[model samples]
Target: MLADGTIGEEELRYLADLYAAEVRTSDDAIGSFLDGLAERGLLDSSIVAFLSDHGEAIGEHGWIGHGIFHEEILAVPLLIRFPGGEWAGRYSEPVEHIDLAPTLLDRLGIPIPEGMQGASLLPLLRGEPAALAPDRMRVSQRAHGIGLSFADAPGLRIYFRRTPSGPDHLEVFDLGADPSEEHNLAADPASRETWMPRLERYLEWTRSRVAEDRAFRVKGSGIQEEDKGMLRALGYLGEEE
Candidate 1:
């Protein structure tokens, strides 16, 4: 869909239909597996979690894939089915992927690691109103130096795109008023003054964290001409790259 940089409505509709059908198929499979487990008395003591890493953009924001700061790509479904359906209720609070590990540990009565950044959602799952701190911020980033830096309290979102040899680009949006991110508030003096400092602090923290972790490094392996051609055909790598 992204190869020609144009996505027709009919194409989008077709993709949507295929997605729905796949979802139904997956649901049926899971249901059958769980039913078998229950019949064998195995599911009475199990916890099930259904989640996606991220959502697809479809035609939103002129994008079709993930790895963006847009709400369509950031928001994902998370359904936790506790044993015996205990404390089953809908939660509307915003949570990050990092919270999943801590939540599972907490449920299993294990202590969360001291260096973990996410809080456990056990309280929320137990019908308690577990609200995030007022100063809490959520961040999303891609390997291409694009970042979404935002604070829930201030309702401010900054889309930062860094170039290898050029000035970084920034687009700010007030998510409270414009969830679609249609307006750029970065040029406004007051908005910049209010949000820039927080963004800088977060960036500094990220840099320090990266410096402390030397276990993994990103290195590119030379791609063969055939692989490059295949990727280009798949609309992943552009000719300029």
Candidate 2:
């Protein structure tokens, strides 16, 4: 913007150009790989999946990276093509990366391991009726902030950010009405009262998962029996006392 209220575009955008170039390179590689599969008559027999681990923020919200709760960073495309192009369609429901493993396992006729946080999305993929997911919630969190989206409440997102020296800042957006998140419902006391209580179950679940992950980390830190000898020789392990 300038003094005349005109948007200026005189500067060169080298970073954005580089990002686009990288995306094109990836596209070329993927196209080549798929062509090879087709050349070998394996295209129809393949179950191809395309997805990104996270999104990027290029000069949006004054940030330029991932690992944050912004929708620009959290939203990523997931495209799965089954063998013979079965169950091909677009879906609008909320899903996470955790669901991919279970879906693959289910498709491969393998038993899903117990206690996985994600459920198989086979029903939805196949366009079959699915049971209501009362506990369906998408949560992204860090040490200082958390963002949440509930299945029952599509297009609604809530964010909580801990300030360095004050109360946690809360933001709620009804994306259906405020797609840009310009109006924060959290500023309203009535809206806050309604949404604040919903955080309890999500917080409880987060704590439990954190505890479980901690225990697993502790167990994993133990030296393996086969590696004990090498570790002992390398002074990384002590003799049993």
Candidate 3:
């Protein structure tokens, strides 16, 4: 609750309530738009999705915004409402934003590109046989930290962090037991033995993947200022950053 250095608890509550009000206002607008679409009989025929590229941290772990390694910031839902309510249930497996495009293409019966790094969720959505293999481990990153967690055990997570003035840091937590991450299990042999090997393998693979991406990346002039403002309006820079 003391995430802000300058604000007292009263001010913080006021700000949080303001934020919630804004969110509700936006939700109301979206609901009205959807109602209009339904009135026009277009809601059933169109593919609609609501998702976010990143999540916010209010006061969890004293973090005030996105770009931190925690479930609060990384586990936002990727909700897609398929046309005609074809897939109408919740999904509990781990998935990433990269998978969205392939899911869309698969849903539309288009061939996915060979080089795409994500798998489609269409089969899983429709409850088809031979569902995509569940991804066991998911890795996420921010400017200073890289985190890994297992799909099978959602509550266990580990983080590797770079410090500006010291050696890197590692954190291990059983979030089920310590949702606030108040205990550090990094030095425990049992915890290290269970998670270190997986971290090592993932790091090695990441090195190679980074190299490949760099080698194949195409250079462009970068975003213009006007485009950046437009992107901010459309919610994508507000996405990654």
Which candidate, 1 or 2, would have the higher lDDT against the true structure?
1
lDDT (10s digit) by residue, model 2, range 107-197 = 9999999987677889887678753353356665533345455522445677755423577666688777886667878668766656667
* Candidate 3: tens digits of C-alpha lDDT, residues 1-241: 2434766667667767877896688679878978898999999988887777776666766766665567787787677878788868888876787788998898889999999877888766667753454434566543334445452233567776553357866778887788777788889897677778777886777667766755542235376767866856643344333
* CA lDDT, every model vs. true structure: 0.73, 0.68, 0.69
Higher TM-score: candidate 1 or 2? 1
TM-scores, all candidates, are 0.77, 0.73, 0.75
Error of 2 at 64 (Å): 1.8
Clashing residue pairs in candidate 1 are: none
Alpha-carbon error at 75 in model 3, in Å?
Answer: 1.9
lDDT of 1 by residue, 93-202 (tens): 78877788888898999998999877788887777766444345555433344454565347877776664457987888888899888998989998777888878887
The true-structure Cα RMSD of candidate 1 reads 4.6
Per-candidate RMSD, Å: 4.6, 8.1, 4.9
Error of 2 at 159 (Å): 0.9
> Which pairs clash (backbone N, Cα, C closer than 3 Å) in model 3?
236-239
Tell me which of candidates 1 and 3 scores higher on TM-score.
Answer: 1
Q: Which window of 10 residues has the lowest lDDT sum in candidate 2?
A: 1-10
